[model samples]
Target chain A: MKKILIVATIFFNINLLFAQSSIPSVDVKDINGNIFNTSQISNDGKPIIIDFWSTSCKPCIKELIAIDENYEDWKEETGVKVYAVSIDNTRSVNRVAPLVNGKGWEFEILLDVNSDFKRAMNVVNIPHRFLLDGNGKVVWQHTSYAEGDEEELYELVKKLAAGESLEEKH
Target chain B: MKKIILLFTILAFTFSSLQSQNADLGQIHGNFQMDAQLYNNDSLIGANVPSEKMGLNSYANFNYTRGKFNAGIRYEGYFPALNGFDAKNNGVGIPYKYASYTSEDLTVTVGNFYEQFGNGLVLRVYEDKALDYDYALEGVKLNYKPYKGVYIKAVYGKQRYYWNTGTGLVRGIDGEFAINDIIEKLADKKTKLTLGGSFVSKYQADKDPIYKLPENVGASAARINLYRGKFSLTGEYAYKINDPSGVNDKIYKPGEALIVNATYSQKGLGIYASAKRVDNMSFQSDRNADGKDLNINSLPDITKTHSYALLAMYPYAIQPNGEIGFQAEVIYKIKKKSLLGGKYGTTIDVNYSRVHNIQETQINDTIAIGESGSLGYNSNFFEFSKEVFFSDLNIEISRKFNKKVKATVVYQNLVFNNSVFNNGNYHKTIYSDVAIADITYKFTSRKALRTEMQWLRTNQDKGEWGMLMLEYSMPHWFFSVWDMYNYGNPEENKQVHYYYGAVGYINKANRIQIGYGRQREGVICAGGVCRYVPASNGLSVSITSSF
Candidate 1:
């Protein structure tokens, strides 16, 4: 009877673990070392842009820099904020500061050095971007970067920022 | 909290399905590819694993969608990974899982993922299934667009290693705005162009007392992509700071790496050229690193990995500590209606790449972190050293004689440093030649017979070899058999052979295959990525399905 109870307990625990594996929330820490829970970073009445990228991807850089160059102008027009997450590990951590400072970017920068945040999101490739709305609901996403893709991304962001009902794209 | 997440998943699925109901929602679609083999270890042939064996390897991706959101997962089961990738196989759970929601310009993903930045010289998180690898991050991603052609993103997460998270934490930020999207002048056809740039950085702690590494490092890049009707050019210049500790023998030289790639593509003709120079930049998770030893921050030698059997054997490994290299590839298609072109037409590809060590000096006898000028030896760029790390020169020609017959011939010359690429003793250079012929006969619209023949010759390293395969694939079933014969060897005792056969059945979303054969010993590299797999022989099976 004791063995049976122990086996039952083991299975129960495994089930519990697997159940919690879906959409696990995380206390994200940005490059500033400030811990921001999901609620703190989420936009209340506006759309949020979340880009999961690393310092080593060429295409991800292209996508990110293109947005940064016009970020100030974008915010004035749409009032949207981008939360950039870095997945660099110990070895490449040293390059983080200089690179960001030199580029003069103004996005909300965070760190996932241990990749805890990345795992929660189930990211398969860099330049992985996700769009969330005022209700903290995901609205759009894409997996790769191609020329002129940003234009499509902007049209969606603009509609969301304007508080207009989003018409699904076919 | 758990209920909320579950509700989110259900809602996301429901929404995506609603939108995709008539457009293939709830339907599964993805790519399936594999490379299997057989091995024979003859006692007199100096085989590493002397046993008759066979192996099967494959990867499959499945997706299910609802209305405004979707959930997808990848299933990869390799019964004894490919020839040289025994280490990547960790007998465990499914390697991928994720649920996402997207509507218009806003998107969110809460699960595992992958990412990267400029040239990956400073940071990159990705997965190449062909190499039996997956580097997905686990987290929540948000993407927002504020303007017509501008976008921003924020992600918080951890990287995936097999089924678990990596040791250190990872975080970053990146943004891009389109010029042509916002400016009317830039959108004109006469000067149609788009220019963008990005800055990204990662952070981790120096937990081990062995090295006083930076707590937070940021890397950035600038790029411009100009495109017209038939001509396009994209280029990015990146820079990183001095990262010193254990990886570089405690050498205090700052990690400096740069890469530039430009490509021009036309209707049937394409040209790609890239160049890179790196100095004292052995970027790795553990400062005390070993060849083929990766713990994250692995920027494989930017040098191209050749495809020819010989050139690929000793393929060049990027000298992260110091190296310079460039690669150029041109692909041209022969027009069918033009003179000198046959009825079916042909395509020709020529590619070449080479790399050498970069020179630098130590500023002080003991180089410390953050110390700028004269910290390490400095040398002129574009200089070549006595050591020729890696080089590849090859050309491939493919011609389709008819609907049932096609052939491809490749000739290549390669110089590889076994010490650098193999993480083993002895630096060996090898020369090789490879030829392949494939033909197919379609018995009906749903059934076909295909055959392939390949031969690889070498003078150094392992030996000379030949391979032949015949595949009979129909609507629901397929079978294949192949043989690899080691005909010539510099070492009389190193001549061995291998053969393998496999058959599978495909019914819509499900497929199964099984095989047994001998495996060879070599490094398998695809798309500038590589892994070492050991020789093994065993029975393998695969099954995939969706609900």
Candidate 2:
């Protein structure tokens, strides 16, 4: 009986909390090893896309490559900025810079070496994406990726850029 | 129970008041994961028959955040545990909970937490659910940033072992300083420098009958990193005081480890190299704990992590006691429309890694190498013994034939010493060659088909093996089937086929997968950490979701 009550209380709390939500503040490092808070990622009325990835995840690489191939067009269309966050631990962190340089990806890359930001975002898998509005409010989120999944992300970015509310559609 | 209810009611009322004020009360977010398997006895492959016949592992995390305050609790359930997991993890409860608050320059956490220092050579407390390994510390942690570039962290706790705390106390402190940011003058320079150091100590009362042991053992490490333009270099060294443990056969020899890595990259080419050596450096929280439990420090595995089935069969496991190894890799992209490059250009990746035992000399003519109650052996820090432990050389080429199709081919040569993995019974080294071809074709914008064909040839252990996998994926659904056959086993009856099939559905942040398969016994490794997987015929279901 006590267990049931505790579980019920948790669910009630979750319901109340989910009604008011925003992107949590977490510290991450850029490619140059400087710390910056996630709350400071706001743009001047432009949408931002954050992609969580790792060097070992194939789907993540595919998604990033696809987005990179069309990043210029996306930026031009929606005035959007993309941040590619790598959750590579120390074992593979050394390869991240070289890998990014070799691939010639133009998006800003951030390193979450210990996965602190990942846990704060409640991300369970790689290739996860979060779409934040111009105000730095998380509007939409998606996980996993198949071929051509980048199109959906771009569509949402375009919508967010047009001052459309994602609370209804998403 | 009444007090609990009253407290929850008060919290709920407070949140309601905040909601009415139109303030950003807080956010509650978490993830849920469940894996369940139903097994069938298979004596042919030496699979153990479980009386329960079914196992389930599940966890749900709940996190609440309001301004600078955050709290979380995780409920874990392991009914009968999994086949490969330790039997002690057969029950379930809320083993992890924490509350933390962050001010402008300081943060404090109470309850359970995970931490790592430097390259995790001196201390690391983490959890890996896949391996049923959870060593989160239950205590208090503090983080303070005194200056713009100086950060210090300290923690004191007892490690969680299954549902209980280990019989030891651990305390650690670490500090990191960014030299460029600290001095302010070098901040605008092109080169970056960072220095860090950590000290960790574990206390476990000595209760042995034979040899006298130190109740407290300490380890310390220092690291430095430098980065300029397209080049970066990092090095870390650690030292531990003499402490007898099970992994080292109760030897009293002190431990030491050193790791160095460097990388240089350009637009189309990247090169990376790393070297590591460890001597008697197995630091666990408990002196008698074995397997993957109570590990307080982790050694970084410099070898490449393989994802392909056949390529991963002979994965290397880091020998924490004594090993010297190095790895080098190069990735190059051929220019498009060049002689060697096609329309879409080609990517070439080559990697090589090798590990050998550290040079060891007997302390004296009277005592054998690595004997208990003695210094064990004297090792030359820079010298490598002739005894090869493991080596691998692999190359891969990927190309796009058209806009709708892409393919990759890989070949690898591996030399594995079985004596290190298996007790000493299998002392012979096995050499194997592997080949793999992976291709994916897109039928439409939302439809795709991918296939993999792999083969391995070897004369030792299980001899030769072949595998084929096909996967079809759509926007919302995916289906896959795979089969692995051991065809060249010396005993005809030993040759068997392991087949598996799975279907998955994905909706936003949620995914569900169901698979039924016959598994073959093998050692599964990730980041040089390994666990033995038992053969079983079973149906498995997995689900994960986040909000």
Candidate 3:
């Protein structure tokens, strides 16, 4: 039975070569404990930034704070939406909402307690950022963060919102 | 061997089809990481002399995804492993691989997988590389959601132990239901409720001569979550049947755990409180395994996780056998224009946590507190013991002085029972006060400098210590230097200076860092899980890239 299933899976995946890049339809929970499908995330043709973070990661917190400090300017310049995904697991999941509320960050916070979405996205480290185009295709991705990394991210967001291809320069 | 050939064949066929079709071909993405260290002996700080004098750990992951189908594999290598890592990890190959398919209402996964059920009180399969821990289950898993707001998951597997599977088999199932979503009328209401339950069991052959042990150990948990506007409460209760294991000294004692959390938050203020009690709740896949090995469940710690070097010197380690703990925190932001707020407003956070040994009474006058082949001990579920294991109170304040300057200050008071947590000869309690100040100044839009000064005062363990760190960063490059000095040790010869320097470069999706440092022997912790890091003088290099 297992061999048959493996063969069947291989055949099905072979035909999937022509599929477009779309967000994985994994289930994630909001701060209020409501489940939502990742494929349903849309901002009406605006580009989106998904940040993978955890409560214990200092670099991740620093990156999010930097983005938060300049969030209004980025939104005003380009129709960009930032979603902060917390992969805190059960060990630190309880502290996530309080931390987000305390920081006064205006980004949508999603909980990936089991890291389903993180594993699906192949994120190996905290502070991993994914830039999704208006059509929900991932156009650019970066890992790690320094002091001035948010500016680079904002520039890409502007280019993406303007319907420019990221593959050329970035 | 056959599986490897099959995997390669599939990959080759997939790529060939992609080239011929000239289609989207889905996506193939992965990441690579390598950490190498050259060690030197330092007798003063008890640094061990490694026979190899160097170690390397590396891994490369490849993931392929196409709509509803996905597959991945991780290849790992450890040349004699790191100095402090388990020697058993000296060699490695493909420790993790998985294939999965998902539809609108159902998902199926085979091969190696990681999973958790209901806050992981009952079961969890995960990997933490820093701890040299990877217990991914070689398993079959299924997730079925027949209706809105309902989720059901089933898993059967044997955990991975080094290059081989553990001696025990694990099986579990979980179900969750959201009341508001399940009932249409309540969907639009403000209040929401979720209920969940799980049952997990592990089977191992009993081969002890002194006592009779159960072959199948079972654990179950029930949880509830309620949310209304800005207030929310969540709780879970778990129970296990009598199971003898090494951690509990082979005692046939039933285990129990309860965790409750409540929170209320608004725009500029957040409040949270949580309490937990665990009694003899150490569940493991292998009955004889100990430490961070072959664990099937996770016990949440109530202590606040500190990020500062000095503040984290003495971290809390969960005593899974029996512990009762509680934590409370409040975060408030002062209005911008107020006197204490300054121009950009100030935020303050206050947190406190405490844990104690659970009250236990001996079964008989001479049986002692816990004995083998016994029920361990009897105790009142809500009783608190007079002995305190750990306590901490901390406060932090942050403010932006100007567009170019920002500062943060923190103070912490901690009481750690070294005798209980460390299990060493020093049986005295440690009382310490730590202070930290962090300041950052942006030289320009693309340049910045940050500094951290920390002081820890304690007369018990290592005495008073001080640390200073300075960092300079540009758009893609960063350099840092730090030194920690233990100046007040009673034994003058033991006082040492631990210094470190590092440089890093980051590109689009890649980073490389190199550092030379004298590390102080201490406990490093992540989410209350503590590991002892041996002192060492070493040069380390790390590289990470994703594509």
Candidate 4:
């Protein structure tokens, strides 16, 4: 009845949106305790990869370690930047800085204490990753990490860097 | 046929009108997840098939964002619910919906939202689906940034209790000020500070037959933070007025809590210390609700969350009535080419934590310690009780060997109090030791194999246990199998093995996994929150997608 029509109208509107989308704006903080917007996640026309993680997720640490081991080469070859965002709450948020420094990860770090950015991105799982093209359009996205998954991530970065289409637009 | 035609006509008309007005049609983003399980009767583990042969739980969310306005709706369904979840989640419905708009310095949200104020000491409205706990407030929330470095918010709503809202009305407001951000001169200084405070209260009609209960209860908290070069400190204290509730044995004692943490970090080295003391600090929106229902705030955990199967067997449940705990951790990395560190270097992590019951004495000679309708007890702010609740000490070492192999080893010793978690069934204290080893071998740039071995030795409770697992993964697929063996059970016939296997596929932002296993009864905890799950033999399948 009435509910059916309401759901239908919204469904149609969503289906009609086909253009490439850019990152949504949401408030987040840097490790230095500065509040900023997610739209500021930029690489100056270079490619960018954003990884959502938490302090207690074991798989996330493993993936980040692997990426760090190969980050220098990736930067030199593709000019791709990495931003690792921690979705820790107020209490655990303090651990993010120490953990990152202890692990010696050189990627840019952002803290999403209330998970505002995570909710905006519709990310339900940690280690959810997204690769944006030079235009800030999310050209590729992934969830979960297997042992060699970073290599596949690099493949998509290589294409996006070369101005190639990910063919992920739906 | 008529519905389809109307749907298309309305779609076409709205699409054309909206398309002609704005260049950006806005963006639609959402995520969906479904988990279903088919159960079987297994006598060995006390698992019995439910009347429903199968159980399914699913949730989907759709969010639309256009410029400064965004709206979303979440639909959750649990067909008779899974074995572990409460029976209340047996129907299907739209449990969450919201619309919000943001202006320069103000944002308004209506319908439903989640919020937290200053370490969540007094107020934190949130949802954690895995634990089947969601307290999403259904009402209005307003946020205002009146100044450069000041943020204030107010909320009024009733907590969602399963399919409906709770009987109580909840309201709260919070504000925070960043001194350095507000004062331009202090922006560039070496030190920084922030101050925050919150006040929250709940109201419900009192209709008790035997006792007179307070219809309105209020709680408040204040916090401060400090940051300097390579070091940071944070502390929060909360206090609540006298109130009687079902969870606290109906005692009319005021509540109080204190939490403090400090940390210092440098390259390849990190040190942390934290302490918390909670005494009758449980605050619930509903005066007579079940345990953990309609909770107004989240109590922070001062212990680490272990990922190992054996080490996490007996998890810590927050002692809402009264307890004190402390934790310390250090992480350091060894230089490459050093004697202890191989060619690729090594990382070592050490952590320790302990919890003790808070000392309590009689309020007077006329009343019992925890008698209903009486002042619970008198507790000194810094006194330690004679009984120990829990303790753990663990260390981990991770290293890389060549370009294809990486490994990690960990050892832990822990003590658990059975009386606390078992509802006073047995007050025996149990001690256990655990060891785990994980290794991975890369076959190519996109292929790898991993293995894990874990063992736990103990002289109490279930005695000893062992586990082994092996997994293989490619760029888009993974397969794994493992088994937990309780081989040292006191009764020979009770020794049993809980084995499980799973295979999964991942493509871009979509994943599907299927698993079959004999799950052992245990509690799963995250951030000090816990959920009890029963042992079962079942085939489980799950699918998750995000766009």
Candidate 5:
């Protein structure tokens, strides 16, 4: 009888939580020592790109560097922002700054010391990328770093940035 | 009535959420999965399980994350397990529960988790589904990165014993450094190197009134990996102190192992080879454990996992306590337009593997450690032992003809030891050859037909076998028929086993397959995940989907 009540309470809470859902909110610390609110990262309801990556992941680093090479052009054309979230925990955390500095990556970087943000985003494998619309709703997600994948990503980002409804793409 | 209502409510909720576009509850999306099976008695093939009437197994996992915080729960279920398995598991329970936080340079995980240190020679906690094996640890793990290219981890945990904890505690530390990244000035597109090392120890409170046993047993290993252009090399060596209990008995013995591998690949060609030597490295819980008996940590040998249907039937079981083995594999693709490449190009794969006992002393007397006397007599290292464990030589070729058709052919030769590898009362030696040919032809852009034929011949073990398969598929539907004819079995009369197969489909995310066949009981490992599926002569159905 006691166990039954406990299970019922838990289910009730889960159902309630599911009903009041909105854009996911996360707190992340940037590499430059600034706490950035993920829900408010992009201004004027612009589309945001979140790249979950780690230094040990070869494909992630390559993808980031490749994007960095063309980041300036992408921003000028689409007015978009890319948040490279470093999922490197304590075991690989110290390498985060050195890796970024060494690679000359100039994107906004945040540290989720406990993977608090990674879990909120449902990231199982890296490098996972999520595209958010102006209202901060996840519109698209893809896992793994592959060649030419970023090209397709940029096309979607541009479409969202143009205020074009991207819900049909999913 | 109440139970049915609750179940219906649950199903309705599940269905409704699956149909909704906003089903994801916040940033974390999680789901649970489980699979179970029951074994029925069959006099044929000697599977007359009397008391062991039914077998059940299940597992569920939950994942949640928000920002830098992540947590998960894994619940496992087992009831009256299969033969040779412990029956202590009879209910649903939490085998693994953990919460972890990752910062820029630091991560901490508290609770139960699986980990491996340096090829798992000293410490490894893992699960093999095919083997009905799950060894998880309840512990706390810490990872710290002090600098670029350097990482360190410290972990402490107690192994799980059914619903309880093992008597022993395991502690380990591992560190790795990538020199190429650390010394960026010397880094280029050409040269790279990574170095790692680990130390692990296990401790159990002494509880003996007569013989004294070491309270603590420890092992350490170091590894190096170098890569330049198309060449790569990796090697690790580990050593553990002598602590023989049940498995080794009154005989006191230490353990040591060496593993080395090298590979070079470029363009359309790839080649790899690996060799390992182990001596008295069988570390387990309850030293008295025998076949189908274990209470603690046991590391499975790292060896090539065969892929061919027959080549994999009797896979090699690493003899960590005493064994020497090597494997070599090569893959090549005939370049298109080349003289031998033909019009559509061809891909060929070749693999070979072998294992044997290591040199050992047959001394009957106990030798004290560090004594001036030689511990044991020296024996030949490369010579084959009286027992042949396992051997395999296989090759496969695949080709594409135009855009409508593709075909592949596979052939393999295998040698399986029945007495040691299988639970046969006598030496079951099987020398066999198998061949399979598969072809796929497309009639339209989204319609296709696939056909397969396989033949296997042998004079030992399960005897001769043959298989035929046909498949037809469209955009949202697929149908298949498969038959496995067991032309022979060493213990049973030669008879052909026929299996009919059929399947219904939705989209890629949902499909249901039903089949009736003489399913061979064996271990199946995919991407390092393993599970044991028992042999059954009944209907088999599978349904899977992900939204």
Candidate 6:
């Protein structure tokens, strides 16, 4: 069984090369304590960036701040939207609202205390990011972030906003 | 031999079978990871060289979903297990597999599943790969949303014990209701209210020949939440019947716990505070299992989880036997262009927490308190023992100096009772003051350099220490080096330096990192669970990806 799973891993990787998947519908919570569905996440026919973060994850905080520093300009220029998702469990779930409010980040915040949405996205680590086009189709994704990785991400966002995404052309 | 050949043949067949499907049929997705290490000897650090000379651990999960039906399986493989991992994990098998169906507001699942109720006082099923902890229940689960604001769930299963399942039978039911969502008149009100409750029970056959034990144990918890304007408050209380397990010294003591927290958050500032009390709250599926097996509940600690390497060395371990604690924190952002805030802005964070043993008294003078087969001891709910377990005071300030530079400074004071962990050494308390300076310089839009300087001053245990780290990162690649020096050892020749270097590459959802270094022996924790890593010198490689 283990050997078969190895081959399955390779097979899935290969199959994903030509795959285009939309977001999965999973139950999560908004900052207001409302149960929201992931399928409702949209940017009014514009680009969207979904970020997974936690309070204890330093790199996740860095990446969010790095983007927040220029979020206004990015939103005004491209009409792009960013959704910061907190994966803090019950131990720190209450801290999410306060920290986000204190930081004054101008983005939607969702709480995934049970990690349901994270498991649906096949995300294994924090600082994981996903870029979706106007059609709600995932165009690009990354698992880890360095100090300057946001620059590369912004370039992708620019290309995507210009109607250069593969799905958009189709 | 023949078994290997058979497995490979099946692998190829399964791959082709899956590849033949068209995109319109359904969706397939999952992730995979592999970690391998090469070990070496180092006497100074007391590193041990295993006979295998190497270790390899890997696993993969595949899930298929089509409309309302979903299914998945996970396979794990270990080559004689890692140095610190349990020997029982040396085999290969599929320990997790499940299928579920959902229609409208109702869903049903069979096989392995993870869950948690309220504050997890009565039940919680979870897994942490880094900590080698998974209590996934193999059973049947049901979830239903009968009304607008009403939700209910029920579970019946046995706990997963490594490759097999525990013999005990466990069952639970949980229900939650949102008053604002259900009521038409209060829907638009600013004040919101929610209430929840859970009941969990376990049954094990009594096979002990010496003393009669309870064949059935039950526990329950109740929770409430209120939100108004910028303030929110939550409270949860849990209780358990008499459960004389291996961890509680065979005392027939009922368990109970209470947790309460309040938060006031608004634009530019946030404040949070909470307190908790636990007494004899150890509930496990197996009466004789010790350590991390078959645990049915987890306690939340009133402390912060630090990410800094040095600061994480002395984390507080939650005491399930009995404990009392409180925590408070404030986050404030200095306005931009202010005297203290640069052109951008400054963020200040202050956090403090302390924990201690609960006060306990004898039932009577005739019998010594906590005697075997007795009702244990009595305690005042509002009192705490003089012996302090842990305390921490920390503050952090972050600011962007300019367009090309950013900096953060942190200072902390910590006190840890090492005696609890040192087999009652009596006077092994450790007190330390830590300071750290972190700076990042952006050379270009796609390139950056980061550095950190950390110092820890102490007069106990291993004494003072210093650490330095440097990293250079590009758009897709990164290189980093770090070193930790124990410079103030009581014994002159025992002082040593631990260093490590790594190079990693990241492209989209795929990553590979290679490193060679010396690992320090310490405890790594997530939530309330923890794992101990032994000191070793070695080279390691890891690869991970998701699709």
- Best-performing candidate as measured by DockQ: 2
Clash pairs, candidate 4, are none
Give the per-residue lDDT of model 1 (tens digit) for B254-320.
5656666555555456666777777665554433434333333445344444433334555454455
How many residue pairs clash in each candidate at the backbone level? 139, 0, 0, 0, 42, 0
Docking class of 1: incorrect
Docking class of 6: acceptable
DockQ, 0 to 1 scale, candidate 4? 0.43
lDDT tens digits, residue span B268-365, model 3: 78899999999999999898996578989989889988989999999999998999989999988887878998887888999999999999999888
| Chain B TM-score of candidate number 5 | 0.84
The lDDT of each candidate is: 0.58, 0.87, 0.88, 0.88, 0.64, 0.85
What would the per-residue lDDT of candidate 2 be over residues B1-547, giving only the tens digit for each residue? 8889777777777777877887776788899999999998778787666788898888998899999999999999988887898889889899999999999899999999988887889888877777677889999999889998998999999999999999989999999898998998998999999999999999999999999999999999999988898888999999999989888988999999999999998887889999999999998889999857888888888888888889989788889989999999998888778878788678888999999999999999999999988889999998999999999999989887777998999999999988987767787999999999999999987789999999999999899999999999898799999999999888889899889999999988899999998988877876788888899888999998988
Separate DockQ for every predicted complex: 0.03, 0.44, 0.30, 0.43, 0.06, 0.41
3 against 5, candidate with superior TM-score: 3
True contacts kept of each: 0.00, 0.52, 0.43, 0.53, 0.03, 0.54
lDDT of 5 by residue, A3-112 (tens): 56556655654654443323345545565323355766664677778899875565586478558757888888887788899875422343355446434567878876
Quality class of the docking in candidate 5, CAPRI style: incorrect
lDDT tens per residue, model 6, A1-170:
67666666556555544365778777787886777889899998889999999998999999999899889999998899999999998878887877887888878999887787887888888889999999888888898888867777888888888988543353
TM-score of model 4 vs. true structure: 0.95
TM-score of predicted chain B versus true chain B for each candidate: 0.79, 0.96, 0.96, 0.97, 0.84, 0.94
Q: Rank the candidates by DockQ, best first.
A: 2, 4, 6, 3, 5, 1
Query: How would you encode candidate 2's per-residue C-alpha lDDT over A1-170 as one tens digit per residue?
Result: 87777777767766677865577777677776666677677668799998999887878987887898789999988889998999887777777877887777788888887777888888877889988888777777888888878887888888898998666644
- Per-residue lDDT for A99 in model 6? 86
Across residues B403-504, which tens digit of lDDT does each residue of candidate 4 receive? 899999999999889998767877799898999999999998678889999999999888899999999999789999999999999988879999999999
Tens-place lDDT digits, model 5, residues B177-210: 8786688885674667788899888887667675
Chain B TM-score against the true chain B, candidate 4: 0.97
Where does model 1 exceed 4 Å of error?
Answer: A1-170, B1-66, B70-91, B94-99, B102-105, B129-132, B207-211, B281-317, B337-339, B360-376, B437-451, B544-547
| TM-score of every prediction relative to native | 0.64, 0.94, 0.94, 0.95, 0.72, 0.93
